[model samples]
Target: MTPSAVANLAGASPLPAFAPRPRSRPNSASPGPFGPAPRRLAVAAPPRAFFSSAPYQPPEPEGYSSVREYGLVPMVVETTSRGERAYDIFSRLLKERIVCIHGPIADETASLVVAQLLFLESENPLKPISLYINSPGGVVTAGLAIYDTMQYIRCPVNTICIGQAASMGSLLLAAGARGERRALPNARVMIHQPSGGAQGQATDIAIQAKEILKLRDRLNKIYAKHTGQNIDKIEQCMERDLFMDPEEAREWGLIDEVIENRPASLMPEGLSAVDPPHHGGGAGANGRGRDRDMEEPSAV
Candidate 1:
């Protein structure tokens, strides 16, 4: 039987069907099902306000400022992905003619450091660019890419070795602007022949071996030229991993000063000197990984 017919038979009248009423325009101050809707707050000059634990205020039409800049009148400016920190000391150093390479080198990182070098050159060619390095090593081609760009730029790259510059890192430390290459008293430097592993067929392995030899010869010459040593001497020195303390590095023409005399000039401004990269590599952009195997046949 139909529901309506049954209902009429059982009772006096059929039950009315539910029909929802169309809601008209909501009131500006109506208490909603979830309590009163929060009014859009307008932050004034001095009276600071907090609503929920989320967005500081509605994004302004002009721009947005980061929470990092809460010291002064918050200028709401949109943030960017250029670098992680808004007011990190490293970010500040980048602005002040300082570029740091504190880990293993790679194409993307080398590209960024190269771009920073170029941009700083465009800003002021005569000013010196400080390059703080604390790295183990990385792909030969990547390091060379940065090395070539450093030479191409007009501004001098004043390299400073903080902890250790090894393999390709040591090459960069030596290639910095002459006389300005300096290292902390206890910093270490190392240079060794490029090492790599080859996969694939026997013929391919042979080809890779030949290329490694050529790379070794070329690297020897580069070291000799920069260190003022003969090619033979450099080749012999690099046959095994040659380690050097700052003093010994100076004697080997790797760095100009051991930084023993200058206590006050350790940092440029009042900012404290940055700590060097720790022993085991971390997730920092530059210290990600060691890709020495890919350095076998470095690209031109």
Candidate 2:
């Protein structure tokens, strides 16, 4: 019988049953080591595919000479492949007068990248930088690190999303400078509650569950701080796995404006005339993953 028909015949509610005393996690507002800092947060995704692409050898700009000659440095993180990593790109890009960070960001790698960027910027007082983001979204901690870094940087920071920036990625975009500088398109921007899986012995599994709850609470605080929405409202939408398009994100104060595309002139100017792929052994843009298997990333 149809679900509606059965409901009518039995005069019973058709909604799915909720388990009694359902296990719950703490909210992100709790004060603890796991709770996020209050400076404003943004987010990003992981590169689960690019890792396998042919080893990359970053190009060297010929006669790149003075930093002034090239207005900005291009730091592209296009692939989100597992074990490939984001730090590899961030560290190198930070050296440029103008740095652009983009690509599929993910996992613990994203956290490391943002941390390194912040560390570098903190040490270098003269660095002026901007960020370019295009991602689907991945690890929450990594996203948080990127967001925090943006707030701490002394130089002006701008964020522009080209294609789609969903999930944690959208959060990072929202964390950009307030007012006219922060812009995204009418493209879709998604937000949802954080989640993860655990597997272990029953006792260990129980312990893992507790940790997961703590993580959930921390994520709740991130939403509350950035969106200025009550935790309850955030959780309500999260419970249902909500996604927002560009228009909704802007209305919610998640983005500044909807733009079509970045001016071509905004492109990085400091590439080496004969620049090799940023990495030493990567095939770089070519469909060859062989070198990547044998490659180890260099210190940027």
Cα lDDT tens digits, model 1, 1-300, are 999998878886466778899889877599999898787887534322221111123433555323223254222222455533244445556667889887666665688789999999999998888898998877787788899999999998899999999988999999998888999888999988887655566776677778778888888888888889998788788888889999999999999887743222334443332333235533333333221112112222
lDDT of each: 0.73, 0.56
lDDT of 2 by residue, 21-126 (tens): 9767755565669566455476534212111111222334676332333356444343345654444344445544344434444443465556555665676754
Candidate 1 Cα errors over 4 Å, as ranges: 1-85, 261-300
**Candidate 1 lDDT score at position 205:** 69
Which 10-residue window in model 1 sums to the lowest lDDT? 290-299
Please give the lDDT score at residue 192 for candidate 2.
67
Cα deviation of 50, candidate 2, in Å: 20
Best by lDDT: 1
Q: Model 2 has how many clashing residue pairs? A: 39
Tell me, by TM-score, which candidate is best: 1
